[model samples]
Target: MDERLETLAQRTGQWLRTHGWRLATAESCTGGWIAETVTAIAGSSDWFDCGWVTYSNAAKARQLDVPATLIDAQGAVSEAVVAAMVRGALARSDAQVALAVSGIAGPTGGSPGKPVGTVCFAWGGPGAAVRTQTCRFAGDREQVRRQSVIHALEGLLQADTTAKSVP
Candidate 1:
């Protein structure tokens, strides 16, 4: 695991604990790495709700309720799909904050438009709030996934901090 990611996860877990918010994750290519990183912290169970590894299109639809039509149209790696995944995770769990990821972190799943290191992420909470990002990383499968997890944790920390400062 990246030391930077570990630091981000520690900060995010502590921030969530401070704000009295819990988190859940819905993952595809990264396969729950974000969740694992957050839970790596001691007492994370206080702020970690659950995680779903929806690797397949069908599993995304079934587990996270990612719409079948959306996956068919967007191919499971688009901003729309990941936003839906985050919404679904928030809906299914007791967590107030959620992060979701879907991507092609591979040496074989590359396409002309969506390449091997393309990853999409979404983070949000209940009510009218959500944010999404897409990045074209450059690395092997493990590196890309690690980067994605780091970005996910960073986003969560940012969101938590911003929410706290709002009021």
Candidate 2:
């Protein structure tokens, strides 16, 4: 793992612990990289709850309760699906906070609207409204995945600063 990612994970763990919260992750495209990065930190079990890698559309639908109709309408990488994914993560875990990521991080799989490196992210919990974003990063597969993980972590940190507490 990158040192910066490790640092971000460390910070995220601290934030979650401070609020007596735990985190769950729903991942796609980047596989389980987000989960892996956070769990790499020692004692992450204190703040990390669980993670699901729903790479295929079917898996997303079945595991995360992301509707098949929604995926057909908006695509798995769309903001809507990621929002659903985050909701599902929160529903399935005891964690008070959850994050979801779905993207086309590739040397291929680029469409006119959603090119490669196009990723959607969502964060939500019991009391917080789900926050969603679509980002277009420029990089190869590994780089795009790395950026996605960084952005996911940054979003958590941002919530810590901007809100009274993270969801």
Task: Specify the highest-TM-score model's number.
Answer: 2
Q: Against the hidden reference, what TM-scores do the models get?
A: 0.91, 0.94
lDDT tens digits, residues 74-111, model 1? 88999888888988898899999988888888988999
Q: Candidate 2, overall lDDT?
A: 0.90
Off by over 4 Å in 1: 159-167
- Name the best candidate (by lDDT): 2
Q: Name every residue pair that clashes in candidate 1.
A: none
lDDT of each: 0.85, 0.90
- Candidate 2, residues 18-101: lDDT per residue as tens digits? 999999999998799999999999999999999999999999999989999999999999988998998889889999999999
Pairs in clash, predicted candidate 2: none
